[model samples]
Target: MSSPLTLAPATGGQRPRRLLVVLGGALIVATYLFLVTVQPAEIAGGMGSVASLVTLFGFLGGGALLVAGILPMLSTSSLVVMPLGIALNIAIGQIAGSLGMQIYLDAIGTVLVAVLAGPAAGAATGALSNAIWGLFNPFALPFAAGAALIGLLAGLAARYGAFRRVYLAPVAGLVVGAIGGLVAAPVAVFMFGAAGTFGTNAIIAVFRSMGDKLLVAATKQGLLSDSLDKIVVFVVVALIVYALPPRAVRQFPFARTHRVLGGRTGALPAPSPVKAAHGGGSGVA
Candidate 1:
């Protein structure tokens, strides 16, 4: 059998590229904060479209920079996988929202990309997912920062072998969910006045009725919603990834390099001498 395709070894520029990814993610979050806090409240009424435009462009630009940094590292498989991830996120998230479910399983694709690619690609996927989804649902725009956080954390969790077992995935998801809630709470409360799905609003109202502050109530609601959603999402992602053919999983350079799926050390098998003689070499797939 032919050897699996292998990515190039780490290069000196990897650090700089990673730095760019960090900067891009930060910029996206920063833009979100600026709009929510710095912009006048009037923007909510007369300038809502403009504000939405700013959010869309902010995420788009940040995503661009992030994608540029990871471009070299991405395999052809990743290119194909990203769109699938985006589609899954939008379709499932919309369905959940329409049903007014308590949890939004929107970040499944984001977590999947992070597992297969890396933190940067995962973050970009989340940011861009919201930006694109914003076209159909503007409410999703403000939460791009939170989405990016989920992607970043999920990728980090996978890098550290969180997906090595089925149970560990939910633990990682819980951690990601908390951080995501922290980031999303302010956006939801300040921008939309805690407006969300029926279940989400009901949770916030319960907290409010219990004498919790508005922000605090919204925060609790976010924590509960995000944490529960991520647990299911992470578990689902783990199962889906593990169910994939090993050969297909191995196509992801990040997964192979980090042994994310917990297999034989991700070491590439020796190339066939005959293929080598014919100038055939492994390429990123």
Candidate 2:
């Protein structure tokens, strides 16, 4: 069998790269905070409230998400960190609006990053993403926890090699999502108590007020429906990422460095002379 591929040995240069990763992570956190604290209220009040101003901001948020999706591909560490940031925004958005579909997308992104990296990085991304949402919106704490759990579970699945197969992606997401729902249920009961029932009713009422068409849209295309859709989307994204070249995967800035490949001890063993000769002799005379 061929030897495993190995990355170059570490150098002091890693510190600067690490610093960049930290800074990038910090920037993501800040952007999420702004989105959570500022953007939603603006969107709710009406995009036209400030005329073109709010619309401009909405465009900015969309642009940010696109950039974020692309950024994780820039480097190994970034692959993890950038996705963590996206996951945070997704969790907060899900909680704030009960947009289950968005949460699913975030979960997918988390799993992709984790699989490319490893579990600890995945868990960190998951935990931190949910934690940030929790801090921003107390009402979302349960969902935040759920989102984090989904990330963690997805990471675990990836670690065990369960997600390497495209066909298993949706199954893995469904299993992970069910676990997340279980984690969120008790918390919802504890925190919202009967209020959650009332809250759901209130949401239904609001949808009703918007008319049957809107209500149907909300129910069919909203949180619960979106959650299911997200599962499908997550699975698809996982499949696509799985098919990508490792070098392409490595391009993401948030991609995690595999722990096995991170240290000097794990460096690829030098090829034996016989094997090298058989494969292709070294150009050296």
Candidate 3:
């Protein structure tokens, strides 16, 4: 018995704003790509190895991801990309076994952006920002795909009646995050050097060396505990996104537009008229 929902066409005035937003997003993406691919390799040895050099590149990459997450809040079209980017980066980190510099960068950026904006915007920005960064790293392919999927699923949740009710956002995030984990598990295992003859042994050896005594003890004592930590983190993020205030959420460059129901039909209200130099209407009038 319920009527089918329909979206209204955007008004003419909104076109310029939308165009500017798209252009800005493209520029951000381009700049991020350059930083990820050309800049890092040029400045450092692809991955930062030297102490001071590593720190510098680390700061730069982290700053770029943070900016990407924050910038999208300015426009609705691009706001959701952050979460997608974040989800993708998380998958990549989990899959790689050895968390790279990019993971820290993304984590810091995502947490900061999510705290500032709501979880939805935070998640979107996180996803898109990481996706852009991933373009430069072959290891990121699986994560990027996963991030894209999460973004799409979250958007769908927002569009549906029951899911958009704020309280359900965390549930939405959990479902999406779980799906991301499932998809990334096999890809991660492969990427973690399990693809070749000695890959599994090699990876285990590497883990042994990296983990050392403390890590080994921790792993042996409670693998489930470590996994629970990760799940808790994801759920916390989802809850944060859901609970963020509208005003706070609006601060993000990628903020979603509030859909006003039963407002004036058709287009948005026109801009107020400007007075002429002579006080009366101008030539155009």
Candidate 4:
């Protein structure tokens, strides 16, 4: 894939970005009011706050910014990877919170896309995944920015060769998780009031029982859960990369960049030469 700095094109190659920029500016004013005035009077889980309502509007603004990244990163290859990424997110995401665990397996696919492609593609995978999540449950709308951040950071980590060594994967994940936690904290506090489906919410409840501020409790919970989730995700992706055949893996944009072709490039064995020949050397062919 091209450098993340290599923007493909603006929406309509230009016009939409201009419009979004204007919309985003307006949303910023709303967000300020929400955080400054609205959040203070909130009772946990109560649905009454013009400021918080404005923050929800900010989620749309955040989504627009996230989507804006996709246009420049969008390509046929990214489109190809995106469906699989979303599927991975949906499928593994379901595996989460079973038996009351805090982990979310959702971002495996998003990180996979980021490593194979770049931040823009990864960002698309994340944004689209949450957009789909909103179809199943509207509560996911606020966390879209957090998901996008995860994908973006994973792509940036891969671009810098974090996947080259097995050990470095979690380090990358940690970074992604830390930033993701910060992004998600505000969403959970102002939008959802720290209520959630997993055991992480139990942790929030624990903090709340201790009289912790809602924002502080939510931030702590997000940091613990999101970081742990992403650490597992990065490590899992590393193992998957190790197990994949080089030829099969090479179709991705970051294949060469990720060193998936050799130890110098994190390469692994492919099908035998004869096997490839008999298969007409056509990987997807």
| Predicted structure with the largest TM-score when compared to the true one | 4
Each model's lDDT comes to 0.78, 0.46, 0.40, 0.74
Q: Which ten residues in a row have the lowest lDDT in candidate 4?
A: 260-269
Residue 99 in model 4: shift from native, Å?
9.4
**Ten consecutive residues with minimal summed lDDT in candidate 3?**
258-267
Name the TM-score of candidate 2.
Answer: 0.46
lDDT, model 2: 0.46
Regions of model 2 farther than 4 Å from truth: 1-104, 142-144, 194-230, 250-285
Which runs of model 4 end up more than 4 angstroms from their true locations? 1-48, 95-102, 258-285
RMSD of each: 7.1, 13.6, 16.2, 8.0
lDDT of each residue in 132-250, candidate 2, tens digit only? 55566555543443444455466677656555556666676666655554334333333343134344546545665766432232332334433464467457656666566555554
Error of 3 at 53 (Å): 33
TM-score of 1: 0.74
Candidate scoring better on lDDT of 2 and 4: 4
lDDT of 2 at 69: 36
lDDT by residue for model 4 over 1-285, one digit each (tens)? 656887765456533354553454356445644664566665454654764666676866766665774555466777888889988888876676565545778889999888887877787688778888889878887777668778878988888878888889999888899778877777777776667876777898898899987877887888888888899999998888778766656666576655632374434346678978787544332
Report clash pairs, candidate 1.
none
TM-score-sorted candidate list, best first:
4, 1, 2, 3
| Model 1 local distance difference test score | 0.78
Q: Alpha-carbon error at 199 in model 1, in Å?
A: 0.4
lDDT of predicted model 3? 0.40
The reply for model 3, stretches above 4 Å from the true place, is 1-128, 131-138, 161-170, 194-234, 238-245, 250-285
RMSD of model 3 against the true structure: 16.2
